[model samples]
Target: MSQNREMKLAAYLVGTGIHVASWRHPSAKPNTSIDIEALQHLAQTAERGKFDLAFIADSLAINPESHPQILNRFDPVVLITALSAVTRKIGVGATASTTYSEPYILARQFASVDHISGGRAAWNVVTTADATGETALNFSRDKHWEHDHRYERAEEFIDVVQGLWDSWEDDAFTYNKQTGQFFNPDKLHELNFKGKYFSVKGPLNIARSKQGQPVIIQAGASLPGQRLAARTAEVVFVHWDNIKEAKHHYKKLKSQLKDFGRNEDELHILHGISPIIGETEEAAIQKYNDLQNLIDPYEALKFVSGYMGNVDFSKYSLDTPAREIEFPHVNSIQSNFNEMKKIVEKEDLKVGDLYTRFFGAARRDGFIGTPVQIADELEKWFTEKAADGFMIQFPLLPNDLEDFVRLVIPILQERKLFRLDYEGNTLREHLNLKKPKNVFIQKTGASKSYSKI
Candidate 1:
């Protein structure tokens, strides 16, 4: 496979790190979940490596039954907005749910971050789907919308957010002290959007950003989720752990672009990988084992059980042989349930295996050797079209993150598989993605509409 494109990399920093037991790892920094400085350092490390983005993910409510590491999290947007102050080049991605958030407010918040970061902002759009996750929050819904309806709402939700983003043109803000013309009214565009899920008034108060609007990132595996990602997501995150599955998903999503009149290049498909790096193969294996050993199997089971359609796996004997059984329709995340079913059926994994087999962040076969070996695997994935790049979730912070930048990134740079320096300041530019045209301005091709509002 030819490797012409430089692979894009984003730091997926969640919890203390991606691993369930990451915070408790001896090398793990304390209070990373709430520690502003810790998060900032991680972002800076990614920037030092010239990574494309730093993505923070969140679910609406804490799964009280979750492992201790995951129970506490800073709000993603607030955290990224803070990180934007410390890092200059890397994009800040904050996850917000379409199901629970008010579109207008969500739009303003992300737009604010975009301005704060000088256009290095991305919104990782998600629908809240934890069993009792929504109810546990402030919502009073006894029965949450089914998977299809949530996607339906999400589709409309994104449309409204994007529409709200178009409320101003790039040239709208003009402080003409000489003429006393405070602004170009003609350049301000109002988004009079009325949709099933939202009714946003004309024009967001924020001016057009360097990227025109915040980049949209989506992770959807369900049919509807896939469709939504194809239509609107600038970057699509996938849970694919194998090359063959990654290739299949990558091809399927790219295939959907033409239907939306979008170029395949317009959507970057990134597979999530948690890299456990070491100076040597032996060191890397030892580090990975140490991380996994930190996890309490019972706590891990509870964590996956919540996500696996709220099934009480603890009730089943630890050694209960996993079998192919049709799970009932789960409102939480049908796609995850489906994925787990396939894994169990294929591997014949048992309840006992959920700890490392399913819940652990460190994938043994992933970029798990010396820096050069890690780069080799990444290059193969990039060239093979298994991924446009990787959403890299480090196994531990400061140490693990520091090692990747210090070691693996240079190998990728030496091989010309990754960039050593950022050519453009904006996140979209860093990713070689086009800044989106304002929908309202695209239609009129003139600034007259700004004043007409």
Candidate 2:
């Protein structure tokens, strides 16, 4: 590996933690989900650790069985916007569904966040993960759009949003006070885009921000999802249980970059990892087991059932091996279903074990270790090309996150694998990603106004 190569990290900022039983943890403040101060502290903690970004994941629909974080939470964008104001450097990103969102409005919202945060903004584009069609009902649709169909619309949705983002060139916003003129008319261009899924006209109201444009982050691992990320994403999030699969997926995505007229350097592949760190390996094991023991079998089954294409695992004998049953066709989060299937076949996981197995990512035996050991695993992955960086989903908020920052981060920094101090001000700078040029100016040289009187 080149000495210049460095690991990028994003703190996955869920209120309690990523684990399904996190809310029940002894130290957990269950109401942290809606507590702005608590969230601000988390974001600040990530910033204090010099993380590249603080990310929040979202889903459109929720039920009685939904995880505590999902059941009651601030809208991700709005929460991030608030976090941005309190913190100065670490980037703030949130998930937004391309399926249910209007391109124009979503474009404006993120663009505004970029400006508000002085360009430390990212949009984690996702097609809604509503496997049960419950989200479709929320949107007044009788059925959820098919998987491929959602990605098809997503491709167009992203284009429209990007088009609107390019409405004004970097120099277009010239607020001349002495002169009557405000902004260069010639530099502003209207989108006037017409697509199979949407038709949007004219430029966005907001101008480009400090980083030129908000960073584009994506996390879909399906074929269509991969295609979308290859063509458009600057940062791609993925999850894998083992290094071999992670490396294979990493190489595959990087190779696809060329097919989209991009270079491997232009995009980053981030693997999602939830680390359970302790002063000693044994301490980590005990901590991991403590959280695992908190798992409510019923709630875990309910959540897993929804993810596994809404299969009602409750119908099966809890003692039944998952491999013995036939799973229905998954219409949502195909990558998740595919991964769960792999685990079911490889392990003798009974139906009762499926939920914890999936939610745990089997971390008790994997990333649960002392700081040096955890750092060693991270170094191995980064050096071996298994991942460009990691999206850390700490098992418990504040506590687990603080442990990683206080213990593991310094070791990685000492080895020159991670930055001791933030190298740049914006998210793009932190990741060493290039700020995208205004597409309108790139194609037309001089922007042509598309406004009609």
Candidate 3:
């Protein structure tokens, strides 16, 4: 891809909230996060901005240990479906865990969303993370699956889901009321999928979705995570605080695609980013600073510590330099720990400062500047191949989204960095990915080949 046309940006909206504590600021309408009208407006705003998709993150088990103030309510797929009804364009992507779900049920849910949305849905595959309080939620036991095992199950789970999706041929539905037949029996095939973790019987009740299957997205940074993403994900979400690290991951991930016998273009790498933009760089800085004041130092510290593998930093004084503290092994999010270490060593960050820095860095790559400066940074990342695009998150709800759509998007449009209008109805078509062939249908002689370009 040409540098000018390289990056593809999408907006991330999780529930009615963003990933920042600053969201409770006076300017924020906290109540609007769950409001249907508010969400519809946000979706429309994203479409107007010419963004690629509206992404939502999900967790099967809520973290009770975390501050109660942080957890908010809304089912992702349901919310996306609601938003889909209000908007004509823009992809609707939601995170769904493979470990907690059955393949047949999930396939139907996503396929139904695709049909309702006219092929704008995408599925972000995730393995459930371990948090202590989830035992009551019907998790098998108090223990979380070993990292490798969870991903192994995820791989098989995805296979079964895809198989079920292909159970009916594209032309299987006849709607022949005159003949008293709703579907052609000969065109349907049974999955009979028996995997290590699950055994699913037969065809999905719904017809093949408009996109064949919704676009697959993954966000695994570990070895197993990366492998799953390389083989199955069409869009890979990455979190890298530094440009060099982001570039390295991009290259390595794209290289892994070749080993999977997949084309590199079939997968897109999108770095998570938090943008605080303004008319001028100084104004943007002021806005970012103001938002930082709302941060509860204790809350920030606790969150960062857990993210760095549940390493307790309470032993160190808040004023003490970060380097003085010895780090311990954190099983969860190992890459995040390494990145945090680099930031501390390079910047000589103190414990107090670490919380503030981490607040911005942890959500997405922080970009605070004038529209021109933000655009220039985005262009650099795209041109340098540091990221194929970004998953843009706003610290403040509507205001942050409003500013980006009004200011930053216009600059990108002028530079031809973003689309002025959507070119296709389906998410896969928008991303330039070919529709996947139905595996079951191919086996039944309803289709000649199962591999789709």
Candidate 4:
């Protein structure tokens, strides 16, 4: 811990909390997502602890009948923007789909928030994997692009958005009262980009930021997804069942940076960890077990089944051993498919066992332990290069969140594994990432040619 890099952490504010049944907990508010004050409180708590960022995840489509959490919530970008008006230092970000959104609109949405936040903004680029949800929105249901094509579109979409963000140079604006000129025409570079999926012309309607660009975050594990992260993402949210697996994913993602001419340090890999911190080691394990018991078996089954490519477990007998069966294609999320397949082959888990096993990984990962014990585990991961830091997911809202900040945070700071105080004004500086130069300014090798002082 004493020899480690400063931790870059983000709090994932998912609904009331990360625990599937956190809302039902006595300490949690079931409807906090809809309550602006609750949301603001969560952001404020993280910022108070000097966290690098606070994250809000989103889904464009809904299936309220099954997954109740995401059925209703403010758009991540909009919510973060609102929060930015209140919080001063911590970076804020939200997941926005590149598959379903036009590049221009998406670019504008994040850019506006970044400007308003004084450059503490992040845009988590994602491709919508919910085909049925798209159908509900009147988008081509049957005509949804397959997995590979979606990634391809995401790559292009991200490229176009970055191009638009570079439309104006850092010093392009010159609002001199004596002079009539509003901006340097030569500094306003037009994108004039034409691609297979889009044709966007010229510079964006907004100017650049102090950080030069908003921080880019991507959560992709597929082949194309990995490449996109390597090429552009400053941070990536990764999932792993073990340190060994985390190490492999971390190494593979970092190795790809060379192909894109990117430095390895440019991308920070934060593995998803939902920690259940208790006053004592014994109590922490019980807290985890209590949450598991509180979860409705039916609801847990429904969520994991959808997560596993919409394979129906409704017809299967609870006692029947889960078998390894391969479908020709999976239209849903694919992160844990291979892991589940391995479990079916090696463990021969029952129908009920399958859901419980999947739910544990999906809902809470890393490990359940006391503040001291959890800190030890995280230090192991960080020192071994398994992760740069963790994307924290507290099982319960204010109660659990407070415990982590109050207990775990002090230990990390004491060991020099985390920041003692905020060292920078903007998120980029907080993370120690270099502010990017506008493309036009970087390539031209020209100094600013101001018409008047």
Candidate 5:
């Protein structure tokens, strides 16, 4: 791979696999989701394949009707921290909700992880969107924040978190035995930040790690979400199954960078792909079909409901055309809701059609193929500016994930699209993102003064 550019790959870890029916797969290891050893192995496998990072998605609350993966899972941030200890190179990241967490506490937690992981930590920022209003109950609230309000809070929330991260300068700590001073008071800055959602007063106890701070990861596709990503996220994860849509999204997000005084190179966009690789095309198709057959219709419906902002689809007959059912306003994943609406309008899809077509365990229509064939598609997407790389959501844990590492990755490596081995230690270095300078230092032009000490 050239020093100028290379495909950035991340493993989206879901306990059994990304597939909703993954736990039911014959080859899947039972209880793997809660098994610490199993999770460690998955992270290690991604590292072995030289993947840039391993990410874990999370939600604030779950119920009997919720997806299987969320039913029995560790807190994502904690799991990523444990996974980081087992893997040396692969960046370990997990979703953390800004809505439910205080900026100071969340900032401290990720900063601590960065130090523990040698700066390979990343925080996937989300304003928890629970249409069921269940998550709000968990957080001691009767209702969820309105969509626009959540984003407004998030805008201030991230500003507070990043400000907290810059509390201590890089050279703030001076273990000067000869002198009485412990840290340079002049270098220390407190963030007495007061915003609409958060008021944090701090010089965070933790210092910035090897990579300055944990990488900021975001996956919002709504207008507000896109704006947030444009302003702060170093990595943006997207899920667009087709090239045309992906290209448009890519170009639009990149174009927005200039508005924030950001360059295109400062951020990376990783499209989500749940590939079902097999020995041949027939084998791949069969593999995908087998998983599709295992999906529970009710579970699939619940998944779609969540995406559509908890709108009940059970009242309608399964055979009823999606258009016949009046879709209500949604407060959950806006992009997903809009995309599904487009699908409903474009295709003669019935309620039942969603189970097999749109609401599967994983989206595999574009990626189900043999290794060479999958590689070809990936290359085309990358070359065509559809995405910088992909977030590989393995549909079946260990089984599918190992198949990708053993079969597909080698082909990507051979093509020089991905690195044969990791070239840097920290997540920022792995992604080729520059270490962010301390805000106070940058403002005061004290970098040279600090270096003198």
Candidate 6:
């Protein structure tokens, strides 16, 4: 069998902020998180480093239980769209929840971004699993949709979104100045889609994007989540703290794709990772320790407890073993909790030590070492089939990212493991993906029964 090519890389940014305490960092700017100029600089730096894409994560509702550190920021779609205007080459991707958004509106927004970015746009498809606060705020109801029901609605949502994207044919818009004709009316389509969850009518008002459609990315790890990804996602984001577990997940996800008649190469599995790079291993370790020391024990405990299914750790002693605590439920985010259990068990960590470990591992897999060492580890994961690539999350905003871009990226480029320059213009082109056909056009004028509109 032929081996896969070198892994691709992307940078993951969470709203207007990097570290939980990044705002407190002496050199950090308070307004950098939401400042357009700062974001433009960040995007340019990533492009200069030849990164594949700059990704922004989103959540519909805020967790009141969490800290109020760096959560305030701009909406992801609006922010990424603004970033697209400033950067020339970097792929601009953002998240939108299927549960909260209408398919027609989302299709227009994503396609608009793709056009504004000159074909460099992607949408991270997420089902809003926890929408209690959002429902209360938006719908005047506090109830959230059940897990299975959310996925079911998501299935229809995906269909509607894709159908809407296909509603406008490639040749639908032909501005013939001489005849004063703006569009070919015959080529226009109406998607009268009526599903169990939603009923959307008519063609999207926007033209087909430069890349035909924005790339679809998914990052759910539940059984239903994996199934959804196998069917619809082109890029799947994953998180695993251990190499062995990551490989297992990669193999399982790949195999599941085969069952759906999809090629393994069609889905790119990118693991989430954070690297603390230094001139030497000792320096990197020292930096890691320093960051760990900066964390507030009480805050770290609260974060970990929520991640572990909201188990209260307030009563537990600092030296209490994690294994002794009984968990009530293992729901959608079990993989994360399971990984925490493994770490605690492996290190024989007490509550305090585990809290510190959890703090270091939040939103990322920690990789602390010298520049060469970091590159070597990444190369191993790529070569060993552990991952196709990584979504890098920086612990501290520009500083951590600057270090990786300046130090480790060069090492990887020297080894010919990473791109020295971009190969294509659009996100699809950069990822070597073929433009998807407009499904509506394929079956148009077929039957009256099919043409409800």
TM-scores for candidates 1 onward, in order: 0.94, 0.97, 0.92, 0.94, 0.96, 0.91
lDDT top scorer: 2
Better model by lDDT, 3 or 4?
4
User: Tens-digit lDDT track for model 4 on 19-102?
Assistant: 667778776778888888888989999999899999998876666324566877898888999889889999999898877789
Who wins the TM-score comparison? 2
Look at candidate 2 and tell me the lDDT of residue 245.
Answer: 92
User: C-alpha displacement of 427 in model 1, angstroms?
Assistant: 0.4
For model 3, how does the per-residue alpha-carbon lDDT over 56-150 read when each residue is reduced to its tens digit?
A: 77665556335322366467889889989988889999888887788888999998999999999999998866434252257666566656888
Candidates' lDDT values, in order?
A: 0.81, 0.87, 0.77, 0.79, 0.85, 0.76
Which residue ranges in model 1 land beyond 4 Å of their true spot? 1-4, 134-137, 324-326, 360-362, 447-453
lDDT of 1 at 103: 89
Where's the lowest-lDDT run of ten residues in candidate 3?
444-453
By TM-score, how accurate is candidate 4? 0.94
Q: Which stretches of candidate 3 lie over 4 Å from their true place?
A: 1-6, 15-19, 64-70, 131-140, 314-316, 324-328, 341-347, 361-366, 441-453
Rank by TM-score (best first):
2, 5, 1, 4, 3, 6
Residue 13: error of model 6 in Å? 1.4
Candidate 3 to truth, TM: 0.92
Locate the minimum summed-lDDT window of 10 residues in model 5.
Answer: 444-453
Error of 2 at 259 (Å): 1.0
lDDT score for residue 436 of model 2:
86
What tens digits encode model 2's per-residue C-alpha lDDT throughout 1-453? 897898989999888998888899889999898999999999999999899999999988887667778888999999999999999999999999998999999999999999999889999999987678889999889999999999999998888888888888888878899897799888888888887888888679989888988899998999999999999999999988789999999999899999878989888888888899878988988888898899877778888888787777778778988899888888888998999888889998888888667765344546789999989999999999999999999889889999988999999999999998987788899989888877776464865543211
Q: Name the lDDT of candidate 2.
A: 0.87
Angstrom error at residue 385, model 1? 0.3
lDDT per residue (tens digit) for residues 302-348 in model 1: 77777676667767777887673334557776666777777877887
Residue 137: error of model 6 in Å? 5.3
